[model samples]
Target chain A: MEKKDKIYEGKAKIAKLEVDESPNTAQKYGIMSIPTIVLFKDGESVWQGVGVQQKQTIEAELNKVAS
Target chain B: MSAQYKVVILGTGPAGLTAAIYLARASVVPIVFSGPQPGGQLSTTTEVGNYPGFVEDIQGPELMDRMRKQAERYGTKFIEEEITSVDFSKKPFSLKTSTQTVTADSVIIATGASAKWLGLDSEQKLRGKGVSACATCDGFFFKDKDVVVVGGGDTAMEEATFLTKFAKKVTIIARGSEGNLKASKFMEERAIKDSKISFIYSSEVIEVIGDNKVDSVKIKNNENGKEKVIKIDGLFIAIGHKPNTDFLGDQLELDKGYIKVKDNTKTSVPGIFTGGDVHDWRYRQAVTAAGFGCMAALDVERYLEGIF
Candidate 1:
């Protein structure tokens, strides 16, 4: 809830991919739009959020999948 | 518990950032809430040649990012959070983000407007693949390809005209009769004179057919109930936009969903001000929005001075 909360940060590994350079990865993920966030669990995408999303929404999604 | 601030500016558009620049320079130290789209609608745009000062041209996102940095250098604190709701009746107005609550003495609402979608399932699925709401942002991708522009308003005409520079052919799909267009004479004539632009009257895109990209669209006639499919490379929905004011509830008066402003930037609520596309449907340019932001900041400064 606070900015200093590192609980969720410690549980997940975040990776940023450049869709331009990694065309294969982008294509594999079927990423047609910019700023597409895909949550992967065990090398599979469980949830995907497109465009701008609220922090709480992402946190809730993360909580659902992480559990 | 909530963080208290003297001034809180919503949105990170040209308006909000410009307000921050002014307020921060005046030692107001306003906290800016960067809504979902940090750079606002302009971020989705491509080339911005008419914002003034720039000799050549700047990309939409680049201009907004520079504005944000300028505001940041001047002591403006930016939070990448959107206010979900607000209560303006209280002395220090309360606002809620998805996570926590915050309070501000004065508020500037520059949340701007968002494009209206067709709400079709297929349209949602192929948004970025080949369907787009912004022709300026996605027109280049349809170069040498055919595309369809939906709507009968000036925005629809403008988008079709702009697309003609890139797309091989641009088709206008109007759900109303041919004579029942909402576009002004100037805009209609400009679009009509374009050789690459054509119109399909009294028709609607029932479905956007595609797999990964837009292949074609299923259009149905409103009069005779005739259905037809036209192959296209991209679909542009230019139906128009709705202001982002759901969070305000009944705290402020709104005109057709846009916040109503009086005395330049002051809204119906005394301490609550507005700028940009949220209050201005006409002349929704970045420069004009920034000007509004500047005015709102000045008004807020005067209002705060009187109180303090």
Candidate 2:
């Protein structure tokens, strides 16, 4: 999506959270599970899923985010 | 047409590989899927002394690798792939991996369970460096040294008991009162009878203190709202374990997130079987997991014969 620039941007970011890290910061924005991916547009979550997901499905989800 | 194997085993842990050994010896070809953790939980562990037949202590990963080699010697083919999904609602069950889909006459699920740990930086930093979850695996390393076991459940009691055989002193850090043990009366009585064991009830581990290895633990007393430090050489997390069965979906019956199997290692769905930590919560030892794995493979072979 970032390359195509069809009003769609998709980037995979990985963050490692240590145990001592505050849960408040991690739980904010309603993240309840580990390895969660949240799709946001205009600072609002459009879709959220946890664990490993297919690239095609992620692309489809980005379409929803773009619309 | 290439004849499909009689059984397909998921996971390459003691359970899966052991099953392959038995099935291959019984003239059944077993194809094993070496999941993300090829050798399962034991791979992450350092020393494994409790597993029988190893007169001299063996490295956990080395033991598993030898098991894999032994299974392969019996003609078991191993494929390194993570099962993305599975379909057990029909005969000749199908499984989807990251790259391919495979169908087998029967499937054995031995994905095993992962130890649950407190999300602490120090804990992660000290993993395999004095921070361990399996007392049976690492307790001997801490002989005559003080160690801390965290949790209020039966697993905690069991681990503390096992550690007493090696540790000079074993401290149980419970999140509740001493009287609030989740273990049965027998286990609770055993724990109380052991003079080497001490209960730090109503306390939770806030930080694991050490440099390259664990030297002490910072604990918070929930009842008094006070913090204190206890010196210990090792930390054993007995909180709980989560079975790796999320990809199983609703294809098989589950009991509290564990795969449910009958006495014969047969699941509710025919031609599909489960064993090891994935289906067992009572005993999570490697020997028990391997025993169940053998049972699941034999059961899969029988199931296939009954149908074909």
Candidate 3:
């Protein structure tokens, strides 16, 4: 669902997970909330959140990943 | 050296975004890290009527989206990264991501707390459909309806008391005996005084029986080993809330797991401000969080001016 949102652009990718994807993965990540976004670079996580954020801030983080 | 910002605000909830709006308006240009819960607790909610200024109630996610847009319009930079770690011991506080380590003159922690819920599959299935965590936000819609509240704490007692205004009958489902209520004497007394409320002691909600919305709850009596199905229109989970600050444990001062704030929104450490549920255990409303966010940003601006 996130992949289709077009929220992620320019070298950034988004993925969605079902509630049962992993054993208490959401709980482990302290995600007692929904619609969380976890940003990754080279298979490493960079950021995560529960809702939409501004574009420039995301770009700044993406720029760091690109470099 | 990596780039450094004047301020870095964490959590894009109402508190964080409100702070960002203030700082941005002041030309502080805060870089707001949206955290794991960007729009905060409001996003998971279905409708928000208590937020004020909205003559007609609006969807929770839509309200947050509007706030996010408002903050962005004021030049607040929003980041989608989850800050994995931080080193507050340094002058220019260092925050590390999987991709880079960035520094900021000031940091505001608005990572809000999350309400705990029963791990029942049926409960999860019916969330926002008829099952909710906040009674204050959703109770009005359940007017003259039967509702079930889970937990034995002050929050549960309070929620039960609040729900009575709307609910025809309020059932308090405690995992333990009625004597095991963790609520304060005043709250417990208040719950006991409510004629519309009934106690379901030593019981747990095995399942919320409903197709798409909560219509009943299957309960198990822990002591008597008895089972019963009670009809209800809604389920309110008031177990408690855990702040999203385990990542910052002991790195800053905390009062009973909640981040401790000094003057206004100032934390124990200088240049590190906190707001919302992460720093507040009481008054965890959207308006209060926004107020704290504004204070934190103003304090951050003062701290930044002294250094920058």
Candidate 4:
């Protein structure tokens, strides 16, 4: 929780979805794997990275999109 | 987004997390780069009955999550970054991810291994739908259904045997005759003894038939070029695993693609050490990899004393 807060830190919001519980959302996004991180800006998915990603990289992307 | 660290570990599996736990407890502050599969192979597995310490079997993902949190509790910094390349020619080793580069005084290569897949378009298209690599991970989903495992090796035997627990029938698609199976005698017998398990010799899966999910598999016989379709609820690929060392870029010695270690965890190059499946293809177990991680951490501490 602390790590999550630090990564977002009011710069953005984060939501996690379990693909198994939400098959429709997974199919909508064409997600084929686990641990995929998608960044949405202005209600549109602007950047997406599959697999585990570093917080720094995520934060960097968040900054870019937030700007 | 570049930073420097005294120690950097390039995986987040049992091996890397164990190394981070040890190094962090010693105040080394190891920065761990959680590669593509953050928790590595075990996370994709289902029941881990052999990892020890638990009264009952633990779910593979839960165990890995506990290990990761344990490492984090000890102040280990985890980055969800897959290293793209490495430069180990100098004192400070440089590792590059897609978005940034970082340097470390000492690096631990516990990058682990990835499962191999049949290179077919249909197979790629239906991955995770019903095509899977770990039977223990996906077998429960196939309860009372028919499943096909492709391979003739020990892993294939193991997967087929495990799948018998859930699948109504488990079939092994082998590329060779029963006499020439790559599985050990014991493993072959274990799988053969199961009433629910069957074998198709000298055959290979040519295509995975699926739309939203796996429906069946197209198999071809190598001897007479006859192809057949088998109805199955799931497909499990158990060919083998390849170590994740492509990013090392010839910086260290390799033995058949796995990092070659001379003295336990010491790789060919100094200041660069390895643990887990990246260097160990023999055991390839979570506990053994974690043990190797501890050894590498201790080695890193000693090497740092000599250099720094």
lDDT of 1 by residue, B1-308 (tens): 68999999999999999999999999999999999899999898878999899998999999999999999999999888999899999879999987789999999999999999999999999988889888886676676889999999999999999999889999999987877899998998899889999999999999999997899999999999999999998999999998999888898999999998888899998899889999998989999999999999999999999852
Tens digits of lDDT, candidate 4, B220-295: 9999999999999889999999999889888998989999998888888888989999999899999999999999
lDDT of 3 by residue, B121-141 (tens): 998877765688888656765
Which run of 10 residues does model 4 chain B get worst, by summed lDDT?
B134-143
The candidate maximizing TM-score is 1
Each candidate's interface RMSD (Å, one decimal) is 2.9, 12.7, 10.5, 4.7
Relative to the true structure, how large is the alpha-carbon lDDT of every model? 0.90, 0.81, 0.81, 0.87
Model 2 misplaced stretches (Cα beyond 4 Å): A1-67, B1-5, B45-52, B118-149, B152-172, B179-199, B205-236
Q: How many angstroms is residue B145 displaced in model 2 relative to the true structure, after the best TM-score fit?
A: 13
Instruction: Give the Cα error of residue B50 in candidate 1, in Å.
Output: 0.7
> DockQ score of candidate 3?
0.05
> How does residue A16 of candidate 1 score in lDDT?
84
Measured against the true two-chain complex, the DockQ scores of the candidates, in the order shown, are 0.34, 0.02, 0.05, 0.23
| Shift of residue B134 alpha carbon in model 4, Å | 1.8
| TM-score to native of every candidate shown | 0.85, 0.61, 0.64, 0.82
DockQ order of candidates, top first: 1, 4, 3, 2
Off by over 4 Å in 1: A1-25, A63-67, B136-146, B161-169, B176-197, B209-216, B231-233
Q: Which prediction has more favorable DockQ, 1 or 2?
A: 1
Q: Against the true structure, whose DockQ is highest?
A: 1
Candidate 2: residue A38 Cα off by (Å): 27
Segments in model 4 whose C-alpha atoms lie over 4 Å from true places: A1-67
Any residue pairs clashing in model 4, and if so which? A53-B80, A54-B80
